[model samples]
Target: MQETAYAKINLALHVRSRREDGYHELETLFAFVDRGDTLLAKRAEQDQLQVVGEFGGALDDPFGNIVMQALGSLPRPDGLAITLEKSLPVAAGLGGGSADAGALFRLVERAQGLPDDWRQRAAKLGADVPACVESVTCVGRGTGTDLEPIDSDLTGTPVLLVNPRVPLATGPVFKAWDDKDRGPMPEGTAREIAEAGRNDLRDPAISQCPVIAEVLAALGKSEAWKVEMSGSGATCFALFNDVEARDAAARAMPSDWWQMAGLLR
Candidate 1:
């Protein structure tokens, strides 16, 4: 079986409060883009996993990669071989690892005839895995595990994503805002995300990596563009009114930075 693990951008992320378990309560509108990783899995004569692609070198430690974790959670079938094609940056708050785990779960279920309970097992691996498994626009809350499906009409919107190439740590970003209390997202369409609010982590993210602020500024300066930081840090996106404007802004980005523009789906 083969599946694509799509990357997601937080249209709006608001950290509400801290929970007893030390996890923060957050409300965010999550949207998946056309860019991300890919995974190919099949039954092997012997149980094994082989990953290859850009950024695949970093996943050498089997235990550290979520794909291995998801595989371990499943019943030992005949055998398995996995080839992971990583396209998204690691720890960029784009849910790359989680999406890979979700893809692994889906592939295993389809090949082994596993039950739907596989998603529940996926949740145990990571909070964002369940939503990644669904891979659609939705409302995520409570440490990012509670998911409610939203309208799937965002495919028409255009998005230009730019990664500053400076990795920001998500732990420190949340720790910087430990005492802050953020407001909730108002009920509305995904198009209203720009006016909803900003991610509380953006300030700390900028503090950690000053380049992020510059990226945000560059995107915001574009006419008819609404720019915001996705998830915790580093990867920022600009929503344009049309594909032409989005492509123009993407082309205007710095050559050293990583940028991709596509119609949101």
Candidate 2:
């Protein structure tokens, strides 16, 4: 079986407060793009994984990869061989790993079924795993595990993702946060919320990787209805009104930078 690990982007992220558990209280809008890493799998006597593609080298330790952990967490009568095609950059705040694991979960689900405690198992893997399992637009809260599904207004909107070829880890960016409450997400449709809302991590991320600002600036030059940094850093996205405009913006981006254009899922 094969699955596409849909790319995740935060339409808007708000850091509510730092919890005693060391996780931040967050309110964010999660959206997925139609493009991302690809995972191919088949039944095997023992579980195995092979990583290949542009960003595959960064996740060379197969056993340590989240995809393996996701496989170990589930129950299967037979093992499976998973080949992960790493198209997305590592640590770019695109939820690349979580999306891969989620794709694996879906593949397992289709072949067999998920346990009743699937959500708990997914949360243990990563905060974003639960959301990525569904890969739909929703509102996430409390460390991004508490999810509330929303009727997204921005579905099918053309989007362009750009990266500065720099990997910014999530830890340092969170540490740099001012720790001020930015208030809750505004009440409105997905597009409306995205327009009025903001990514609280943008400034902190820019402090770690200044090129993020340049990416946002470049996307801002487009005719996008909304342009903002996704999740923590490095990868910023612009939501355009049409595919032609988005494609034009993609071509105009710096040749040295990496970019992908697709419609929102």
lDDT of 2 at 146: 98
Q: What's model 1's overall lDDT?
A: 0.81
Worst 10 residues of 2 by lDDT: 182-191
Compute the lDDT for candidate 2.
0.94
Tens digits of per-residue lDDT, candidate 1, 1-265, equal 7898988888888898878898889898888887688888778876566768867776788766788788788886577788889888877878889889877877876776666577678789988898888788889988888898888657768888899877777888888785677668878777776556677888878888889999998898785446889888899988877888888888888998887676666
Error of 2 at 72 (Å): 0.4
**TM-score, model 1 to reference:** 0.93
- Residue 265, candidate 2: C-alpha displacement in angstroms: 0.8
Task: Give stretches of model 2 more than 4 Å off.
Answer: none
What lDDT does the true structure give each of the candidates?
Answer: 0.81, 0.94
Residue lDDT tens for model 2, 1-265: 9999999999999999999988899999999999999999999999999999999999979999999999999989999999999999999989999999999999999999999999999999999999999999999999999999999988899999999999999999999999999789887899998999999999999999998989999998889889999999789999988999999999899999988888889
Error of 2 at 50 (Å): 0.4
* Residue pairs that clash (backbone atoms under 3 angstroms), model 1: none
Query: Which stretches of model 1 miss by more than 4 angstroms?
Result: none
How well does candidate 1 score on lDDT at residue 211?
93
TM-score of 2: 0.99
